[model samples]
Target: MANRWIRPEVYPLFAAVGVVVGICGMQLVRNICINPDVRVSKEKRSSAVLENSAEGERYAEHALRKFVRNKKPQIMPSVNTFFSDSNRD
Candidate 1:
C-alpha cells in the first residue's frame, strides 16, 4: 500500500545521516570561505593553492585558543570548588 514512506524505526538512521551530511556541508563551505587559493569572487580569482603558512594560520586558529592565550586554561570551575568558594565570600 505504501508507495514512498520510511518506517518509523528508520527515523533515527535518517536523522544521523542528515547530521553527517550537514557537518560535511559546513566543512566544505568553511574551506571555500577560509582557504586562500579557493577564491569565490571572479575579480580576485587565484590559479593555485597559496603556500602561505602565516595566512593559513590566521584563518585556522581556534577562537577558544585565542581567548585563552592571555588567560587561564580552565573552561569552567568544578562544582565542588564553586560551592566551597561561594561560602568564603
Candidate 2:
C-alpha cells in the first residue's frame, strides 16, 4: 500500500518552509548579537557630559572605574579536590 498521508509532491513545500524558518532563526540570532543593549546605554551615558564640580568629578571617576572593572574578564581559580587537579592543562 502507498503512503498517501505524505505524498512526494509536498516534499518541495516542506523544504521551502524549512529554509525560510531556518533563515528567520539565524537572522534573529544575528540581530541579538550585533545590536546589543549595553551599547545603547553606553551611548546614552556618553552624551550626558559630567559637571566640572568636585562631586561630579568624583562620581564620574567612580563610574569610570566601575565600568572598567565590570568589563574586564574575571579569572577564577580552578576547582580544588583531592581526586583531581583541575589546574593541570
Candidate 3:
C-alpha cells in the first residue's frame, strides 16, 4: 500500500537529503558539546553571543575555513617524496 507513493527514482533524492541532514545534525551536536560559547544550560543561554569575542575567535571560525585555513593545497602528499630522492627514506 505504502509503495504506491514511493518510487525507486526517488531513492537518490532521499539519500542526498539524508546526507545533508546528517551533516547538519552532526555539526549542531559538535558545536553544542565542544564550543565554549554554546550554552547548554538555560541560565547561560541568555548570555550567549553569535559573534566572536577574544576567546570566541577559536570557535567562531566557519567549518570550511577552520580546516582549510592553515592547510596548503597538496595534490598528493607523496608526490614530492616520490619525485625527490634526497628526501626519501
Clashes of 2: 0
The lDDT values for all models are 0.77, 0.60, 0.78
Q: What is the TM-score of each candidate against the true structure?
A: 0.54, 0.37, 0.51
| Model 3 lDDT per residue over 1-89, tens place | 87986889899999999999999999899888868777888887887465546547656776778878886687675776688768566
Put down candidate 2 lDDT per residue, 55-85, tens digits, no spaces: 4455346655977775535344333233367
TM-score: which is higher, 1 or 3? 1
Report the Cα RMSD per candidate: 5.5, 12.8, 6.4
TM-score of 3: 0.51
Model 1 residue pairs with clashes: none
Worst 10 residues of 2 by lDDT: 74-83
lDDT of candidate model 1 versus the reference: 0.77
What local lDDT score does residue 60 receive in model 2, on the 0 to 100 scale? 46
Candidate number of the best lDDT: 3
Q: By lDDT, highest first, what's the ranking? A: 3, 1, 2
Which whole-number lDDT from 0 to 100 does residue 37 have in model 3?
71
Give candidate 3 misplaced runs (Cα > 4 Å). Answer: 42-57, 60-67, 70-89
Say what the RMSD of model 2 is. 12.8
